[model samples]
Target: MSVLGSLTPLPAADHPELLAEPVVKALSRLPDASGVLVAEIDPDLADTAAFCEAYSSPPEFSANCVVVSGKRSGEVRYAACLVLATTRADVNGVVKRRLDVRKASFAPMDEAVELTGMEYGGITPLGLPEGWPLLIAPEVAAAEAVVVGSGIRGSKLAVPGAVLTALPGAEVVEDLARPA
Candidate 1:
């Protein structure tokens, strides 16, 4: 069974009060979401293998979304939601090309927090501000299921890969990530 099937189904619009503010806001907008429990985790847990082992799930069940940013004409634009595990976001090549910027780089921490309303360690693609570029690796889309942040540190949300694509502003692309 998919991990999402095994999780407790909380009201999609009602996330725990302990959740980070941005995650809570995002969950409020997604009326059909659910959450799964994980052992308390640190903020910088970026690797899926580590997260899965800590959460006691298969690596493929864990999805990691990175927010990449670049500057143009002294203004910075950010892109969020790179891929699941095993793939790294191609910020300088594919993503730069997609954004039509001459020089692109990952958004700095302060800007990332300000723009997404997520803490440095807990950003999810679900409730990103309108128009933030959301790139999904094709491999992730091919998965039977994937797990993403619940906008909180201690929980995750598992859903069909297709459901992720259906989210507002999500764009599925080929070779969207660099191999880990």
Candidate 2:
């Protein structure tokens, strides 16, 4: 893969090149995740737009992971959703219904980063908390390959769409994302 800069292709399961505990732990549990590739990045350019622009990776080849939360039975439930960079997660509609909550919104940045042990812009589905559903847009799950966060802003991961769909608790949803 032609990455923007020097990217060390590290194994996704071990992810020794990655420093986030939750990310490493989560990846290790995926039996078919061995093909995922992890690469280092300039933390300042970790956001999807900047990373894609600087690295020349088309937006269609990148996927973004977002955390959302809402109250279900008076208890807060959080879920991670994945969508292509060309689209946005349907938080209020698809996400809310899937979460079984009256309303759903993106989790507060601080809460999401702290709870997931990931940087704000680098939160990924590979290492989310247990019981949290990982909703992926069908378009993203059908792509041959995608670039995603590595839990920390300093790095990113590249893996096949099938690998993401195979992760524990991952659910492929139609219209999960809306055009950006």
Candidate 3:
């Protein structure tokens, strides 16, 4: 295995090898996933900045999945936003308007973790709630590959941009995020 940033790269793995059941199921259900290469990392370094610095990875190669929620009318709506680590999801602007809600904010950590059945720092769009749209920034979907959570803090998945766009419910949006 080789090293990527601060993580120990592993040979290409079946989703079941590195991801939780939910993630595995999601990937398997995709019409034709190109497969993901996984790397093991310290759970403590799962956050994007730390993980990138420790692994010698550039921020552009890492994508963050954030869950957002708000109410439109009387019902709550949820969405997952995927943006590069070098940028921030425009929660109050683009996202709120996209979801057609009065306001939007990051979902409470507990609710995110509980609903996704993934660790707090490892929520990926791959296994998000079925009804939630997977809102991906256009830049993120244009990258060659991006490092994302494997549904657990202990590992990461490197997936092709094409494969990411292929995920169920994924929607590529322009300027969904702003450079930080």
Candidate 4:
């Protein structure tokens, strides 16, 4: 119940204006969507650090979502990763091997935004493309509740952490990330 700071959150489905189009659509299709909550914030404070500092939310209140990409043969593959803000995803080691690519790196900002139909700083795993992988660190999937981006800078979403593991193509990987 207490995921983010003292700021109260509303049912995400009840406040479509706070979410991006894709985020809204994704939530609408989930039967467990009732647990998702949304909180409005100053757009300028949308980034993790600023939002936590300003809202009194703990620094680790949420898992951070990042997009990574790698190419294999003539095809390129992309995946979304969720790790604690205090940790960094193992893009070069575990992830590269998982994707079956020779190398892997963070996806370019513009490409990420365009592909996800979401704002750059607010890219989230909830509404990724159908075939993309969703690699989640065990730490993130085991949390009581996870607060993450809403696909827009003006708001954030919170849901039971286990919920993420059930999303399509979500894979829980140990050491998906290492402490920063």
On residues 33-131, what C-alpha lDDT tens digit does candidate 3 reach at each position? 555677878899999888888888887789999999999889989999999988999999999999999999999999999989898888987878787
In what order do the candidates fall by lDDT, top score first? 4, 2, 3, 1
- Candidate number with greatest lDDT: 4
For model 3, which pairs clash?
Answer: 5-55, 5-56, 6-54, 6-55
Q: What C-alpha lDDT do the candidate models reach, one value each?
A: 0.67, 0.85, 0.84, 0.89
Model 1, span 48-135: residue lDDT tens: 5656665466665666788887777877777785576766788789998877778877777787778877666567777788888788
CA lDDT for candidate 2: 0.85
Model 2 segments more than 4 A misplaced = 1-8, 13-15
lDDT of 4 by residue, 1-180 (tens): 377797899999999999999999999888879889999988899888888888888767678999999999879899999998878999999999999999999999999999999998888888898989999999888888878999999999987778888888899999898988
User: In terms of TM-score, how similar is model 2 to the real structure?
Assistant: 0.92
Q: Which ten residues in a row have the lowest lDDT in candidate 2?
A: 1-10
TM-score of each: 0.79, 0.92, 0.92, 0.97
Per-candidate Cα RMSD to the true structure, in Å, reads 3.3, 1.8, 2.2, 1.0
Q: What's the lDDT for residue 69 in model 4?
A: 94
Which one wins by lDDT: 2 or 4? Answer: 4
* Model 2 clashing residue pairs (backbone): none
Off by over 4 Å in 3: 1-3, 6-8, 11-17
Q: Which ten residues in a row have the lowest lDDT in candidate 4?
A: 54-63
Worst 10 residues of 1 by lDDT: 35-44
